[model samples]
Target: MEGKEQNRQEGIPLQFCKNKTKRRDKSFNVYIKTFGCQMNKYDSEILEGLLKTRGFTLTPHIEYADIALFNTCSVREHAERRVYGQVNMLSPQICSLGKSKRGDNYPNKRIIGVIGCMAQAHKEKIFDRLPQVDLVCGPQNLYNIPDYLEDIAKNNKRILAVDRRERPVDRENFSFRNKRRYLTAYVTIMEGCNNFCSYCIVPFVRGREVSRPPSLIIKEIEVLIKKGAKEVTLLGQNVNSYGRDFNNGYNFIQLLKDIDKMHELRRLRFITSHPKDASDEMFIAMSKLPTVCESLHLPIQSGSDKILKSMNRKYTREDYLRKVDILRKLIPEVSLTTDIIVGFPNETDEDFAETIDIMKRVQFDTAYIFKYSPRPYTQAARLEDNVPKKVKEERHQELLRLQKNITLSNNKKLINRKVGVLVESADEKGDYLIGRSRTDKVVIFKGPKELIGKIVEVRIIDASLANLKGEWIRL
Candidate 1:
């Protein structure tokens, strides 16, 4: 036990299999194709870290990989369809990979695993549909992937692990810190959601809300900052409801306050706040904390009170507006972004008009407009998808047009203004550095390549619906 602890403290990763042969220690490349939100991206990072513990190397090229994993999302029908399409296209290529010198399939055959929410949703059905898949592990059982691969390598049987009872909280030790892009990191403070919004499949697939210990979260952020992370975004299905599961009085506001005390952390952010849980104290924390950005991503799925109630949102249109009013009053320069769903079941022309009215009233900086699609096992799926397809398309387009105009107008207002942008990355051509302002607006500017991870003031020279072009002004 002393030796093992010393090895861990020395940064020497122990293999999952202790009695492994010398052949297993050789580096085997893994390619992960992630299709989903930020949470899924973070999950892929964890998956990569776990695979590394088993002596596996990450490869960017799919053709050279010994194993291929798809971290999927089941949020909408469109997202699922995309995963299927990509899997089919890569099937033959994945199968042809990892041909050993001896030409034996055992221990050397290229492995394909379907992990994450989609794996939980469909389970072993993916194996029946896609015979190429060797493993199907869900979000809850992600920690078992490395062990499952070991078993498959020894014995050629396919593995299916979708257990929901176990919470892999200890997986925090394997948070994959990206050395190349240390400007920002995602720290998932909690997992799962109790609020089963009628249109959402999150609660069903992810299970109930389970918040991580605040001590673990703080330690993770400290490590990230020490490793050159300038910013960290606290992630959860609904971030504002962070510590309700705990007996302690530690809530989202307190969590923010504690994280703000980290002097090395330059910026802080969070996402997907539910309107019902958005509180004055949370807004106040955002205003008081110098590290916290003046931006909020409160998702308002619909503007009509009728649709909101039907979707089990638990917040009326007026309630949402009231919260928005409070937020604006507290953080006058807050950049509000949101998610809007159009053409929900039985939605009338009036209901969609109400959505338009809310958009006009709020003038959000950006809105992710998604057409309503019934997810499997969701309450919305049980109802007759009454809205016509053509009408849904029309309304989706109308919302996009309106939001595009509003976003352009908002950007135009920033012209000639100087904003501090945390440089995130460079354009592919290396002609410009791309970064985001405190408001979370993307700003592209010409600067020294050394400015990749530092915050610099950029003067806004041009504006567009997508991004703002700026000139680096060393003030």
Candidate 2:
């Protein structure tokens, strides 16, 4: 997933069908197995919206599904491998149905497809590997999935829709898809990335940066707010570089200011900001905006200048520190989270020490640490992956151990304090309700079922490296 964002269930309105009188048969079901970032989840929501319009309902059980879609990711080799394994596992069951013959029930024959980054990256090669795949669509072509699925059903042949052109999002089209009455929702303000980080495959698979029109974005948020969304998270590959593609003066900071004017909104958040593009003006806006949450997911891939430069990250260690210092000064109570990659090629013991040093200085509330893995067709792939697997594991464990101590220490201070939490869901065990604080910390507390979609004050009673145990104070 992009920047290690946790996956969550996206809501789809129960009455999304075009005709109010027409009831869905629930015979034909589409099962979407998403394996990527929040953007991919948004894409899956769009897919669900499109399918619901076409009279198909989503099903959790793949065995009973008429169509199974794998929304894939290529950020890491492991993600891709998982997709491959899933496809392979499902191929036999799909193939056993055989071709659609005369007088046969078309609904009985399953259709399997792959969408998103991995589909865009592999294209037809995906067919060569997984011959059972009936459709392969890219992220840009998601809106056209129903049409392609229709064509496949009519002709009984495979199809691919991986257009590279910049596609405009139809916010009005998917307005009814916000089914969740949760206080928080994700609004993708932009798509793709322009920064070609050497080890990253996002730019290649997701294409270049394209910011949605501000008017459309604001309108979408308004629709969401009207439907009971209290917080909106602006998503992008690099949110800080949102308006750079446009000739107009509209930028991310300006967008934030515009959204801040929406008094109905209680909080706003954004993610995956590149350190170099995180301007001081943006931090200032964040500090002043009452709706903007006091949390930032700024990913500093590495702390060693040599490793950063080699990864084409553009910012030096000191430059990132300066930005962090500025942000801390402006928002004293802000919670900082970061993404770190260990054992990059040519990194020495001293370089690893620099990463630990920076972690101590920054004291990030949470850190997502990943071991270096060279991606195909990326600049780093050409270089030798000289770091041994054992060494990488050691470095990863060391960083994780260090970050856990820091996180636990930091969280300990929150005990006996009160914080507002937006209740999202009950834990799997059903013993406690799980939600997030304004600072994005996971808080678990016992509460009524009615509190699932509302924000309430909670008093922290216990703390751990990963989450906080709290007691409900009030709604």
Candidate 3:
């Protein structure tokens, strides 16, 4: 541990402090703009928590911030492009601020940084792309942000802290700065990915899988519940493989069971379960755990066996179907959602048809469909992107159209049925409240503002492809 700390310190060099006398007495405010995934959002919360402890305040407005950070994603090309655009928009303003006169209200040296997957994936290249950025740190190095900022403030130096070493999860660093707007919160039980799915950049950027101790996870959720968080979603690249790195016999199922025993937690959820790791014991736990939500987001990138093989997903279509069948048998009310990629490299017409056929058979409650975009450092990137752009768009549209009808039909089945919804917030018009059912369906109904953090019963009156319209039955 001592050697590791020494090496970490050596990796991030501290230059001679020149502007130490110019340090201000005022508390610095940080503005974090997050993009992509629940994991990134949770990361931002941790960032704010750490900054707050170092006498920095969290500000929602970018213009009022002394430090502007972009917590970015590298999942898709568009996500990376969007972050670049955001950096472009903020760079000139930040540069202009640095050139302006120093005053009591305005600091002459405002720092800009990029943190998260994009920072890890791109590394030093981000400096070339966004010349005004003072820091580029990865997910693993986020805990060091306070130190990096302090160095920048004292020495006026650029810092890049993208350490890929396997670090143990620090439970204390996972704290949130303030109470959440809603009752639901996301708790990342594990970090990184071991599965090198051909289309995924997670393994490359997030490093290997490491699960937090089960006791730590339970303790975090318990604390959140005490702070009025009623719903918690466990996040991971592949949540089903959570305890594979440990030898104490605790796994994802046991973790869920432990969390389920928390009396104050109304809902327990998890995401991105691999079909190959969907064990029968897990299904049994889901069935028996009272607080566990009856919803699963199992991603089957492609329904075609050939494409699945090429993607190295390790599960056959039959294997996926069997798991789904088992889940449905155990929990009849379970809502199933999946992810689909339209144009993987060398995907044939029959492969595309198989995806559509599986969609028809499963009638997924919802599906996140995407046109394939090859990511750097992935196996798929080396393969020719054979599918034409026009063809990819057509396939994408076809799947969307098919799923729209299926979702509408599935939602229509709930018409006039009573369901319990955990009200989250008021809708835009303020005439109604919006909440989510246990199955994760968005339901809107007329209610008072007091219903925001409470669960109430509602009768489904109408349905659309995306949401359910309901009448409030009672709180």
State the lDDT at 393 in candidate 2.
97
lDDT of 1 by residue, 95-119 (tens): 2333342135333346677889999
Give the Å error, residue 6, model 1: 39
Q: How far in Å is the alpha carbon of 364 misplaced in model 2?
A: 1.2
| Candidate 3 accuracy as TM-score | 0.91
Error of 3 at 279 (Å): 1.5
**How far is each candidate from the true structure, as Cα RMSD in Å?**
7.0, 7.4, 4.8
Q: How close is candidate 2 to the true structure, as a TM-score?
A: 0.90
| Model 3 C-alpha lDDT versus the unseen true structure | 0.83
Q: In candidate 3, which residue pairs clash?
A: none
User: Scored by CA lDDT, what does every candidate get?
Assistant: 0.83, 0.82, 0.83
Per-residue alpha-carbon lDDT of model 3 for 368-419, expressed as tens digits? 9999999999999999999999999999999999999999999999999899
Clashes of 1: 0
Off by over 4 Å in 1: 1-26, 92-109, 168-170, 174-179
